[model samples]
Target: GEEVAQTPKHLVRGEGQKAKLYCAPIKGHSYVFWYQQVLKNEFKFLISFQNENVFDETGMPKERFSAKCLPNSPCSLEIQATKLEDSAVYFCASSQLGPTSIGYTFGSGTRLTVV
Candidate 1:
């Protein structure tokens, strides 16, 4: 069993500031995912990577947000400009392809606050 690791437990920035979040996918896992949680019961899937390649990104914003999952390097999600509405907890998850009873393993997340 492996676990996804997210760094910088918290982050705070002023409006228009840049925010960068880092994630390390579980070892031996090829898939990485990023999610944004604004409300207690809702999760917005931002992006996903399969072995350094983007697998799905239907929910990601077209502007101001970008992500990278590079081999041998920690994955990163960057927001070029922060906004009040962008304040949320960002979570990283990792999983392998194929059918498995157990699914993704998620990190604790980074709480980003924009003031």
Candidate 2:
């Protein structure tokens, strides 16, 4: 069976520091997605990748967030110059090519806190 994995369930970083979160999508899947859920914000799409190329990144925060999907490696989201507002749960998800209406498989998420 396939599964998504996340590390360090919780993270606390000082303001202006860097925050890195990781995710392993299910094997055989090519589309990986990242999302952020803050205290008041609904789950918002952060980025999407097809294999090693970025498919969509419009939802990524312009100043501080970046993500990548490397070969044989889990995808990662890195936040530079973390801000207090950056505290949230970062989820990594994946989906097969069949249908967009179908839901995706998501990791438990890395809960990040910038203090």
TM-scores of the candidates in the order shown? 0.94, 0.92
lDDT per residue (tens digit) for residues 1-115 in model 1:
3778898999999999999999998898888889999998999999988889998888889698999988799999999889999999999988876223267889999999999
Tell me how candidate 1 scores on lDDT.
0.90
Expressed as tens digits, the lDDT of each residue in 13-115 for candidate 2 is: 9999999999888888788899899965689988898887898999998788888899988788999999999999988888777226365888998999999
The runs of at least 3 residues in candidate 2 whose Cα sits more than 4 Å from the true structure, single-residue gaps closed, are 98-103
Worst 10 residues of 2 by lDDT: 95-104
**Candidate 1 Cα outliers beyond 4 Å, as residue runs:** 98-101
Assess each prediction's global lDDT (C-alpha) against the native: 0.90, 0.87
RMSD of each: 1.8, 1.6
Clashes of 2: 0
